[model samples]
Target: MPVPELVRPAPPPTRPGLALPRPAAFACTGVLLGLFLVGSTTPSPMYALYQQRWHFSAIVLTEVFAVYAVAILAALLLFGSLSDHVGRRPVLLAAVVVEIVAMAALGFAPNVGWLFAGRVLQGLATGVATSAISGALLDFQPPGSNRGPLVNGVASGVGMAVGSVLAGALVQYAPGPTLTSYLVLIAAFALSLLGVLAMPEPVPHRRPLRDALRPQRPTVPAGRGRTFALLATTMLASWTVGGMFMSLGPSVAKGLVADAPYVVGGLTVAALAGVGGITQLVLSSWSGRRAVRVAAPLMIAGLAGVAASVLVGSAAVFFAAAVVLGVGWGLMFMGGFRMLTGLATPEHRAGTSAMIYVVAYLSASVPSVALGTVSTVFGLTAATLAFAITAAAFSLVAALATLGHR
Candidate 1:
């Protein structure tokens, strides 16, 4: 129940160009969001190290990971649409503050319980920040500028990638995997928080807090279901691979490559996410319309690559598989994102985005958790193979469904 940040009561200055308000605090918007994202999963590579430190089982690793995703989804479900009602800046600042607490808790957390508690706080913070920050990027652009949203998207992608690299390297080489990375993240979060405090308030937002307290449901348009269906279908498959690697791929990597450092495991996951970001940009620029049109086939091949990685059972091959799937994931998401943006009007933009994101992140979360749970009952390898097959099969079915559409 924190009051939003103090804003200049005066209306934002008209900068004429795409520039919105170059509020003193606007410069820090991207920085703050990037830091929040980093804190959310910076510890991915270090989870295996924690397992060794605490002598926990694979089930425990996934459970710990699940806590973070669950917290994030809950926050997004409740607060994802908050920025539309309230201004973006206040929500972002709140998120930064929460990040400070989460990072600190991780730094000094005595046990697994502390990890989940910290992750939940961090998740809540992210839910507040993401929707708000992205909107703020648009809000802050000088009147005629269009580079803001694009830059903002790339910033988010880079933040996610770099955070893992930084955390992974530290976990591999540092004396305190849990403490050092969080300490560094803590400093970054604090700086970003201060910067956000200085941003000019766009307009006074008066929405009741009750707006964000309830869970909303997702629905598809009648005619538009084809687009949404295709988008969601491939998204579910691609995100399953994402969740798989994000949550347990590290452990699998370590088992396969005995010489692999915990950080290397992190790099593998980062590489996948990073490659995904890069692929989206590259494909968008180079592939042109024809490429974008054939989303179904490209995605199927990508899922098949995930299956191949399991069948090969090689770390090197796994990396390659990740790259291929990442490409497919990137393309599918890009097309889907564009379609989602297309389907919704200005009034529905924020809510529609949230709906689509809910679909995307849930597939990434619940399916991965299910896969992990089943992995516990069976062996990791067997469970991975099963998940791989299922994803591949889904891709085939979706490809057929979308075949006539393209």
Candidate 2:
């Protein structure tokens, strides 16, 4: 398959005064991507608080989280390529605006309904913004540069880690546990909106809106099915670990450490996410295959630690497991993405990449709901033990598959 030239839109006519330099636009897009992920994870720490206040069940909490994932999957399928047609700036600007609204809704939420609405909007905003920003980064990257995916992975991981930690700290110490985090996010996103406006339009020609919106089902390139499947499996394993930690790690932490700091929940997520982010940056140079090979045991070990933590009801062990989980999550994500990137032709790249995320998000979302339901039926300990065993099983499967792959 022939590689298509990187499509760049003609720069919009120079308007009045200052225009952002190309480098600034690149940096701004990176910042925007980070901000989007941060907003997506900001609510994780608050879920426990919401459950406490509303007297809702664990099933309800997972449903709330699952709504965001559903919306994001819908948006990605519908508008994954929209920016390539209408331009990144417009799509990104609209996404930012939607996020602001979502944040406001969450900040002022009076009931569970409001939280659902806010999360749905947040998912939509993130889904739309993620594609555009990712595409924009590639567009702005120097021709033949391979740093775009690295940047994307790092930015997202950092954003999620930072958001979790920040919200956790604020929830513990701030006057309004629910309100304060959204307020801070609102301010950050507001600035990102301006940054989008100032970003350079990189697509040279606008394709028809109808054409761009046409649904292209996710497809793997010929002879790459095994490779795609392997990546997908690894991603599923990686995301399962993440989903468990993000959704229930805090509750588990609280159980183990009575009188735990309110920030403990956030700290739990931050530890996993923060280490994951740093791992991606540090191992950016490793071969994708090597990364995957290393990740399998790390994840399995981490999951074992998690199971141990639950059995003993130890906070210290839980946190220690989180660190191992973080390392595994980082490696699995970057390695799987890099493998996919290597397999895709230029024309097939976007679609292939989208499919990987579809799998990734599905892994992240559906399992959380299942685990939550299990937690409701069996105890949290029982549910967590089940989750760890299942996640470890997947990791072993992924490792075996990776080894079998040429």
Best by TM-score: 2
What TM-score would every model get versus the actual structure? 0.85, 0.93
Tens digits of lDDT, candidate 1, 78-121: 77667656666667777888888988987898887887788778
Model 1, runs deviating above 4 Å: 1-27, 142-146, 205-217, 222-227, 285-313, 345-347, 404-406
Query: lDDT by residue for model 2 over 96-118, one digit each (tens)?
Result: 99999999999999999999999
The whole-model C-alpha lDDT of candidate 1 against the native structure comes to 0.65
TM-score of 1: 0.85
Q: What is the C-alpha lDDT of each candidate?
A: 0.65, 0.80
